[model samples]
Target: MLTPRARPARAAGGAPRGPPPAAAALAPQPAGADSPAAAADGSPARADSPATAADGSTLVRTGAGWIRGESTEEGRQFLGIPYARQPVGDLRWKEPRPPKPWDGVRQAGAFGNRCVQSASWDPGYEKPSHTEDCLSLNVYVPDGHTAQRPVMVWLHGGGLTAGAGEDIVPDTFARRTGTVVVTVNYRLGAMGFLATKGADGLDGEASDGVSGNYGLLDQQAALRWVRANIGRFGGDADRVTIAGESAGGRSVCTLIASPTARGLYRAGIVESGAYGDCAGRERERATGDGAAFVKKAGCPDPRTALACLRAKPAKDILAAQAGFDWGPVVGGAFLPVQPKEAYENAGAARVPVLNGANSDEGSLFAFSRYDGQGKPLTAGQYPQALTDAYGPELGGRVLTAYPLTEHASPTHAYGATVGDRSFACPALRLNTALADRGPVYAYEFADRTSPPFASLRELDTDFDFGATHVNEVQYLFKHFGLATPLNAEQRALSRQMLQYWGSFIRDGVPRADGGPTAPDQRTRPGQVLSLRTASAGGTAISTTVGDEHRCDLWDAVPAG
Candidate 1:
């Protein structure tokens, strides 16, 4: 999802929280290759092993070194484990390297610093982060499940500029789903996606002289780490499922299109991510933007631009990158072609995919642009706003399709247009494309009364967010370590969602005992599983998403 690139209106930077008492170190267990307690990699044992520390913490040995994590009530959590070396100084913008091996146990309690980014509406990332050493991931495994359980690698959504691996507490999800969950944090914004033609070092690290997609590469590195080491955590690396929402969902699609990421995972779960052209920006356009970014950073000299960028403070570069769209770039070894092209040409990974979008995916975006700031959209200004966004021809067609009188307000009407043009239509196209290659289960999160995030709740507005973008995250996992305000019915729906997701991760199908069956796109074309509470019409196979959301009208327009 292409969110507003403008930094948050509120002040950046918040008070950093202190680590929990479980941050204490643990001793490694005495084990060898012949010991039954030893892991598959000849490392220390699992959570139930005798390696538990005096304080009830668990120690696991990785290829790098020993690390101690907390034993939670629901499962075992290993937080802040670096999957790659710190991207600082000369290492910035380069491909991620393996973290150096440690001598003793490293405390894997508190989460690592978030990738360098400005604050956003997400409560988990409301504070600006300046740290560059943020290429770490967190793993959550259930307490009793010690076998090779299926793994789900989650990528947090922050428009590819903000957010961290700790945005959601997945311990409960891990325990309930009976799967090992891994959340990751990679580089963000320009620091991750900048593709300057001449920023390579003397060693020719960026030898092509045209470099970008470092963030995408970072994600691949994390997946590679999972393949190499997840088995030690009792995770089945061969059954890994890459799942994400928004930008993270888009990252899943990009990874699906990437050749380097083929063997890292077997399946993917995409939520509200089917927007924009996954092929990414062309090399010429990205380098041109990179050149402008370099000049904006006060390093106009192409000869010294790389040195200047390397020397300038991270905050300076973050400030200079304002207004420029940050995402993956094409024509690189990481992603050689567009994702759409890859899917169409059968060049994409042949894996089962569970993909969908929220019903009113653009309401929050509309609120941010209009209602959130106190200037609600007026009926008189609606026509001009549409023209400004989609031009006169498309704007007039949109107005005819979504009349203001049909919606609660002009803002709602505008939101409907945006959601259809951006999310719903794009997602339908992706479902069709992916169904041609492999099984693709499609869904629509139609829970109109879904709870808002902490940031949205804090806003001084009375606008109704109807299953907007990111609204479904709270249902699947605890957002910001807080419980959702779900009612009895919503809670039941949440449980069903978790069950469906769990089944998808464990196997390739999404089925629950009593819940509605999620049909694959190949079996039921143009229909998706509509997920909502019993009172909100209940969950069922909905055949009206296409006509109701006006995808026919949007099919003519370009996806954002």
Candidate 2:
């Protein structure tokens, strides 16, 4: 069913609300070419390929039922494994329940459903095929690896409202890096972030009567599943790297700060989205009020709110999502304060981190706001907008640093400057602040520009959304199914990225076999790897991108 953006237009207590009838129209269907089937033991067939071993025939065990996956030139793929149980019926809005043990082998050939989201915002030209029962993950293991390999767990980004594990295919990285790649799906939108008033009468407690953070809890559950079952797939559970982009990146930061997430992973890779504290107490309280509003609409008894939510049709739950204000909350047992406070106070999980951002982070959001309809805003207008959004002093500093006059167009300068301060710079600050505690590898995706989506390219002409927010994902995962296909140079860069990422997962630092070479050396003091393509070849340019940009200034900015 079609739904609007997840954020609500009205606040709680303003009016009565109910689930939309459109939600009931949604029906469960098999995802893609793979479907769940019973194995010889009457359990779900596993997706692991029997021919995936060095001898071209091996069986791997997993938490769920097992079967053989396809072995191809790319790599061996295992799809549709349930990392957690289906969050349906009585389990709705509660802590993730463990997947029920099956009596026999079950088939896991297909990917589980992606968390429910608005179809409008999905950028890869694909749509969500499944709903709330979407807590599954996919794994890619290289064919030649005999011993347990390093693992990289990837989290996708879609503003906490959209995105799925199916969006990324880690085959290329798996083949090139010889590491196990696991991409996961968790609760999103209202199902994940909506916090309701607890039966204990505590106003700000989590919706599940614990600390609210079901989405984060879902991610932790997947990590636990990985720690328990990854070894069977030739992966080293002890050496794990948690990585993400945009909202996924934000999640990486959140995971580092969450006490429940401690010891689950060894390292982190945060791309684009890394704000110190994206959600605050007021925001969390607002989310709770939104949930209460939903409960009042459906049932009079507060004790059975969860039961009522489960009995309500999926469409109704999704439709009611429009009325709910959702995001992370602070002052709860799980997360006592915002992420920034936790990090600055040294209350976060201490681990090596790899962080960076695109040059045109703001263009994506700007393009979305302008509707690709009118001319881009002017340079003067850019500062005016910042002042409107933030306050005066901060807006003035932002405009001075990223003067619009320097660029060919106001939109270009505005996007570059604001995007850096709001998204990119904060990420750099996170790395710098945490560097002394552990190793930090920083980079900037300075690819001149990305091939534009046909529809969006026509709207903003002057500004070349250089390596916009999610552009690096296809390169990182080597899977462009949801994105445009990569060119030869792009493919080469993907290989380099895979090497850097895999090496990091293997060790704390991201160094390749030959060690830091001249042109594309690893990140060091005063060195920021620039991912650019030259006539000779695509290589890393050691230009002080991070230092020159004054990323250190973030250290002084008080944690929000």
The prediction achieving the highest lDDT against the true structure is 1
Q: List model 2 lDDT by residue over 1-560, tens digit each.
A: 01112111111111212311222121132322233343333455345532223333333445553444545566667666778878887677777877865433234445556687765534342443336878878877787757578899988777677767756667767777778888899888777876656644322333435334788889999999989988877888898999988788888888887787889999998887575434444544754565565665575465666566668876666666665555566655567767776777888888988877776666665655442557567655777876774579866776776676666566666556556666766766676556645666777776655654333443435546667767777676533233346677765666667677777788767664323432212235445666664443455645566654545553455432
Assess candidate 1 and give its TM-score to the true structure. 0.91
- Among all candidates shown, the one with the greatest TM-score: 1
Q: For all candidates, what are the clash counts?
A: 2, 20
Model 2 residue 492 distance off true place after TM-score fit, in angstroms: 3.3
Give candidate 2's whole-model lDDT.
0.63
Model 1 agreement with the true structure over 1-560: per-residue lDDT tens digits: 55442212221012133532322343354543123244334564544443422223366666677676766677778888889988898888788999876655677877777788986655545567777878889888887736688999999888888887777778889889999899999988899888877545211375334367788888999999999888778888899999999999999999999887889999999999888745488777888889899989998988778778989988998999888888888765677788898898988999999999999998988888898788999999999999999999988988898998899899999998888888998999899988889999989999998877666776677798899888888899877666778899999999999999999999999997676779789888888999999898888899999998998898877777
lDDT of 2 at 53: 33
